[model samples]
Target chain A: MIVDTPLLIITDLVKEFNDGEISTTVLNGLSLSLDRGEFVALLGPSGSGKSTLLSILGTLMRPTSGRFEMLGFNLIGARDVDLTEFRNQHIGFVFQAHNLLPDFTALENVMFPAATRKGRETPVDRRRATELLDKVGLADRRDFPASKLSGGQKQRVAVARALMNSPDLVLADEPTGNLDRESARRVMDLLIDLNGTDGTTFLISTHDETIAGQCRREIRLLDGRLARERH
Target chain B: MTYSFKVALRYLASNRAQTALLIAGVAVGVYIFVFMSALIGGLAVLLLNRTVGNIAHVTIQAPDRDPVSLYGRDSGTLVAILKSVQQRTTLQSAAAFLPAIEAIPNVTSVAGVVAGNGFLTKGEAIAPVIVTGVEPDQVSAIANVAGNLVAGSGDLTIGIALIGSGLAKTMGLQVGQRVSIRSERNIDATLLIGGVFSLGVSSVDDGAIYVHLRTARVLFELPDGVSRLEVKLDDLRLAPEVARRIANTTGLKSIPWTEKNEQLLNGLVAQARSGDVIKGFALVTIVIGVASALLLSTYRRQSEIGIMRAMGATRRFVVGVFMIQGGLIGLAGGLLGAGLGYLSLLPFPLPEATSSTGLPIAIGEGAYGTAILLTFIGAIFAAIWPASAASRVDPVKVIGP
Candidate 1:
């Protein structure tokens, strides 16, 4: 059987931040690749550059030096506007803080990504958002504003929002960092079930070993470089 | 609804207090603007009507003559009397020219007047007066003297005269009083004062008297002649055109009242300029108030803006959100202010009637519309800077861990 092309490729990636004459390196000569439909966990402690790497993958930050390609586009060299469009069409992001707009209802928050990209919500998109909300087990709270939801419920809404556009790649950064053990397991189970059924690619960054153990593969980053890889 | 408008409305709805304050600020500004325009514009119209209503728009008179002095005080009172006789070089057959003058476009009414100097004597008081000869119905059509009759009627019959209120008071004269009226031509008659009038102009009130046209003809020894024609037009602004047409046809010296009173016209221009300056300052206040409010709102929603950008909203979309907020604020405030302004006028009483409709103040449609439009556009422009700032928000910087 022939193997399909990988969905992501990063080589010799580096990122630096400058404060006047001083510079701090965030990602130092990192390299990684992932195939389609793969569920990979990025494992690291604080200051290990996992979040920085996730930020770059989400198209929010540009690498200082790298060859980065996603879905065949050279992401590192794309213009700002083109990058925004590419991210809108192909990438979904779930933040640790569950950055749901407080002014919008849970349903509106879940529909936000698609609404922003499409400029309007169609019937199909609304139905998909409703189904996702049902899958997340928050159908009863769909009309509640995001600020009124509990921590776990908000994170679940963020998860539903990430899949709103049916993105090709989903990047989650400490998605369950603020949730309790039971809530964390439930979020992880939801992610695993979506991956298994839809074959959607996932790259989640987490410090929890139990969460890393659940993924199909694990990549460890230390001192801005990949330290270990396991499957 | 478009995405930007929906988002903007949601943001405004979430911050109810801030949105209300913004709307109130714009409403107050618009209200003041409308009120000021109405007050100043009404005042201007009232002043113009008061000055122009009682007088003829165009006065056609005989051409100028070389100035001549008949006597000094050393020449005795008889020489003085001769000097007082107004050089009555009447229009040659004034009746035949009336038809041509009235045929001029825009001329509504034309009345032939024989104006000469005379003296009103009652008991011991004697006052020099302008004795104006007029046909009762014809003069009433050109001037508002018929409306100003304070005592007696507007009847200008033979041997009966209409005297000014001020002249009547000074000479102890009243309606039906037998008064000695001696013209400068040395003709004397004891006439009854049929009416007493006040023209609202101090000079005209103190020194004018009206008599029948035939009676004046017999007194001044000018048979079928008039010194001038008082011309009224459909529109006062069209006086010059009508007067020019009349003068060209009748060989008379036609003068519009606007040209006759240069100082009054200059004062009106200055008043208008001052009103414009006040309006300009009011608009500036509105612009600044709107801009500052929007800037603060943008700053307060910085994180929300970043969230939207991360969700694939373009910079233009973000900018459009703030602009929509500005436009809606302007529209709401404009309507409220217009309503408030019109209502406020109801409680304040008006002065005496100066208009044909018996209204002291007049509302101008064009001025009201202009005030509302200027305020609306000003508010939109005021929001641009804040909208631009909102669009420039960086998602990576704001959302980074």
Candidate 2:
């Protein structure tokens, strides 16, 4: 069916990676969809294609076979320049490892992308970065380098960094997987709050059932295909 | 570009060791270039002043005449053409071009005297000398020969010769010694050594002997004929132009300072050229050092570079950041080396009183501009590969588990 209301539509996505002398296929003809302002989660066992689908959907990787559309732009055959512009304008990514730039302070890291987008960092960028750091509960630690931040705090800063350009879609890959239960719960609550207040759409890949249970929709992957999806 | 530089600064600040290494690499090149040039410049000044400085600005001789090899052949009579160009009263073959030259705006003082080759003898001690026969007044006007005389200058007369210090030692002849003058000329006779003088040049002081023009003419059988005319101009540097004028006007063989001793002049040029070669080698080394340091640092940041690309930085931005870092290192090192070189030359002392051995190490204003350009090139050449490699990275592999 032609889905008119869908924000992201993926049809038959496949991925392969070579492990030493052996080639391994990670995904096989997978299909998925996400609507506007929808907070969704993909859960799977090890070696399943949940992370593969998330990466392909986020435009960080190319699928072997598939056509995906985000906000009316075709990513399947788009040039690198177009893809970069799209990624910069629309997608905010938070990886599982909380990969913050170790050299910059929490606030500077958050403001880095904003300055890049605007061509120069004005006073507004600084204010917004400061406001976002406050939102991540790092107002006091905003000046601290990324290396100094705790695991939970680093993840929070990554979240602030992702949202710097106010991207419409935030793709988070196992963001709270490295956190303790209390920290994971707090991070999950922050995601839920951002979605509720800003109406920002989100897609998270996780193994944590507690975090997944809180999402409005859950998609399960098995053997590189979508086994079931429920709302 | 500002963003790229800011990123580069941050990276350099984070890696102090790498930055320091890169700076040192560039500094070595700048130092080599400056000092090498200084050596060449110093040597050139010394040789030119010592050999050709005290001589006439332009010397006209016969067609087969050579200035440095003054004694190898019988001198030519260039006076026939010179006479048609200008008239003089008496029958002496040469005249003073001094008054005429002094009238010309660009011309300075000029004088004509006699020079010949002879052997001097004192008991068993004998020496060969180029005998410059100057009148007492002419000696004072042509060059500072009287003032440069070492022991006694006023008593210099018919048979007495003001000898170089080195020759004085070798001949074992002291002042007031009765010396025999031998020449293939008319008035060759034994005479007294009235005085000795040093002009600091080994050639002028040691290899030369001087007497009155009248005595030399008598000794050489050239009663009323002069050997050559010496001309001077307002600026010593304009010798070539004045020489060209002399050659054109008099239609005779005229030699300038730069041309008189060609091989010896080439020696100084070769020295200056070596300085440039040293600088070139230094810059090349800087390129190698800078390249290695920047490459290592870039490779170390594989994961971070991936993260940056994943964060939506364009490939151009990725490469620019590293290149900017290289430029910073070069500029900083160049400035520091220049400052150091300038300060070092402050107490520059030379063993020679007039500095003929080497040019003291004062930093040339022009050199800094050259250094700044080279340093930037050195630094950027080092960083280019790393920046390109960083830009070539795949974000997928970078952020992969």
- lDDT: worst 10-residue window of model 1 chain B: B76-85
Per-residue lDDT of candidate 2, residues A8-91 (tens digit): 888988888877999778898888888888999889998888777777777778888888998878899987767776777798
lDDT (10s digit) by residue, model 2, range B1-401: 47777788899999788688668767767766656555455455555555666677777553442223223235763333222323222215455443444554455666666777788777777788788777766764555567776666545566677777777888876777777778745346776777777766787777677778888777766677566666666556688888887666655566776676778767866776777788788778877877888888888998888887777788888888888888888888888776665566556553223454545443342276677688888788888888899898887777852
* Clash pairs, model 2 backbone: B42-B359, B150-B197, B164-B205, B187-B218
Fraction of true contacts reproduced, model 2?
Answer: 0.32
* lDDT of each residue in A18-132, candidate 1, tens digit only: 9999999989999989888899999988898998888788888899998999888899888878888888888888888888899999999988888877787678888888899
Task: Please provide, for model 1 over B345-392, each residue's C-alpha lDDT reduced to its tens digit, 9 standing for 90 to 100.
Answer: 655445335445643444442266776788788888888999999999
DockQ of 1: 0.47
Considering the true interface contacts (CA pairs under 8 Å between chains A and B), give the fraction that model 1 also has: 0.50
Error of 1 at B237 (Å): 6.5
Off by over 4 Å in 2: A1-5, A18-21, B25-129, B133-148, B154-161, B166-194, B199-203, B210-254, B269-278, B351-372
Best-fitting candidate, scored by lDDT: 1
